[model samples]
Target: MSRAEELKQQLKPGQVYRREDLTPYSNAVDRHLAQLVTEGVLDKIAQGMYYYPKQSVFGVIPPEDEVLVRSFLKDDRFLLTSPNSYNALRVGTTQLYNKRVVYNHKRHGEVDLNGKKFFFCKTPYFPKKATPEFLLVDLVNHLDSLAEDREMVLKNVIVKAKSMDSNKLKYAVRAYGHTKTKKLLDPVLVQMKSKAHVH
Candidate 1:
């Protein structure tokens, strides 16, 4: 078999790959990538990103978000979420957003991958999964960017904070909260503390 075929044989369906990953398979990496793309063996999802589509009985199955992002960032340590998820909290945020937010230690800013926009937020700390407490804190962190009435949402946040486990919420606020989020949640958390004293 030829070098191109050797490289092509390395591709696994439903996998997202960065250019560096295929370099080991081919010395003429770029040339082989172009050949594979031309032959429809690989789909170029974004600049320097490629996907080997998985075939289903219905048709072609797109690469999963986790797979695409893991390859794009080249790290599995990232949290994927959407602002639209805030609606699930029922804290008066009802707007639907098309944006997907990724919290990672490496990259920040927005990039389009496979026609979807992902906003990368580089943070020193983030939970492996977006817990309820984390999402609540994240909602307040990005409150200003939301389309809702900011003051009204904050009011609801205080109420929601009271309903949550004080210790867990406090931990989330301290660990994941942005500066503004810290300030916003601080007073409510303190109030919870004082109320505990009263009881």
Candidate 2:
């Protein structure tokens, strides 16, 4: 088999790859990649990023957001979320956002990957999954950015928080919440504890 065919066989559909990943297969990497792009076998998404498009009845399916972002970051230690997710928490938020946010220790600010805009927030920590309490705290952290009424959202957050698992909520606040989130939730969490003891 030719070098192009070897490299093509190695690439899975709907997966992203950096040029460095193709290095072992061919020394004329750029020429080979250009040939593949011209042949419609690969699509270059960004600098040093190429994607193997997956075909479907409708047409080509873009790579999964997590897969694309992880390949771009070259790390899986990032949290993928959107401000729109706050609506699911029933915190009175209703606006849908076009951007996805990635919280990671490595990068900060907006980055364009594969034509999709992502806001990378540099943070010391992030959870693998979105927990109820974590979502509440994250909502408060980014409250000023939301399109909903601030007072109404805050009220709903407090109401919903009181009914959540006190232990898990406390853990989320300490583990994931920032200074403002911790300060805001501390008093309410104290009250929750006091109420629990009395009951």
Candidate 3:
């Protein structure tokens, strides 16, 4: 089979890939990619990432945030946290916040993927502590498309907290300290505690 055909078969919508990923299939991936670019069959989203131009109807195709998130994950193990978790809670629709994608990484600082922005917060913990308030606010944002029972979701959050490594959680709490996020979480925490007691 042609190198182009093989690459085409490997491509999936909303999936991010690197040029190196194509190496196993064909050594001519770069040449095939160059040819596709000249033909307007593919468009580069970043250094090594490309997307099929035809799949974009308006010719206004943009980089997929989730794809970028996955790319960031490839570099290091990260937990989707803060603004990102909040964004996911409101799943079906786009996030309203102006902030970039947030992740709890083993490393520190921020990295931009393609045109999308990602922030990596260093956390000593594996399963990080996500306060109820923050989680709820994110849930409220995505309430329109939620598939899980509200009670079940709330229970899961508490369970997650209980299962978290306490030392790591403490380290994260110290690293982040108190801020707007914690302030925002206050009421939600109260409500969750109240609900748990009632049930």
Candidate 4:
């Protein structure tokens, strides 16, 4: 088989690939990649990055957010989340956010990958998936950045904290919450305990 054909065969639909990832398969990787783009076999999402679009009844489908970021970072050690998701917690966060946040050990700042903007936050801590407690902490941590009433949100957070599992909430605060989040949540947790004793 030709070099281009071999490389194409190796690519999976709905997957993103960097030029370096195809190096082992061909010597003229760049040229062949351009040719594939011209042939509409591959969609060039960014410089040196390509995606094999998945076909559906509607049309071509872009790679999922996590899939794109995992391939772009070339590592799975990152947490994918949206601040808008905090709206679900009903803590007075109702505005929608355009960008998704990626908390990872490497790569800081905004990145435009495959036409989607992602904010890569370089932090030492992040969980594989966000828990309710973690999400609460995260909401408070980024409260300043959100287009909402901060003081009101804080009050709602305290109210919402009442319904959360005390042990798990404490653990989440200690493990995932930042110093400010800890400080804010401490009183709420204490209130939770005080109320518990009353009952």
lDDT leader: 1
Estimate the TM-score of every prediction: 0.93, 0.96, 0.51, 0.94
Please rank every candidate by TM-score, starting with the best.
2, 4, 1, 3
Pairs that collide in candidate 3 are 90-142
Candidate 2 per-residue lDDT, tens place, 79-169, comes to: 9999988888997999999989999889899988888999999888889888777899899888888888998999889899899999999
TM-score of 1: 0.93
Residues 30-71, model 1: lDDT tens digits: 999999899998999999999999999998998888898899
Highest TM-score against the true fold, candidate: 2
Better of 1 and 3 by TM-score: 1
Writing each residue's lDDT as its tens digit, candidate 3 over 100-158 gives 53445555677766665566666544333455433544454334444556455555544
The local distance difference test score of model 1 is 0.92
lDDT score, residue 109, model 1?
98
Question: Which has the better lDDT: candidate 1, or candidate 4?
Answer: 1
Q: What TM-score does structure 4 among the candidates reach?
A: 0.94
lDDT of 3 at 132: 42
**Stretch of 10 with least lDDT, candidate 1:** 124-133
Q: 2 or 3: which has the higher lDDT?
A: 2
Q: What TM-score does candidate 3 get on C-alpha atoms?
A: 0.51
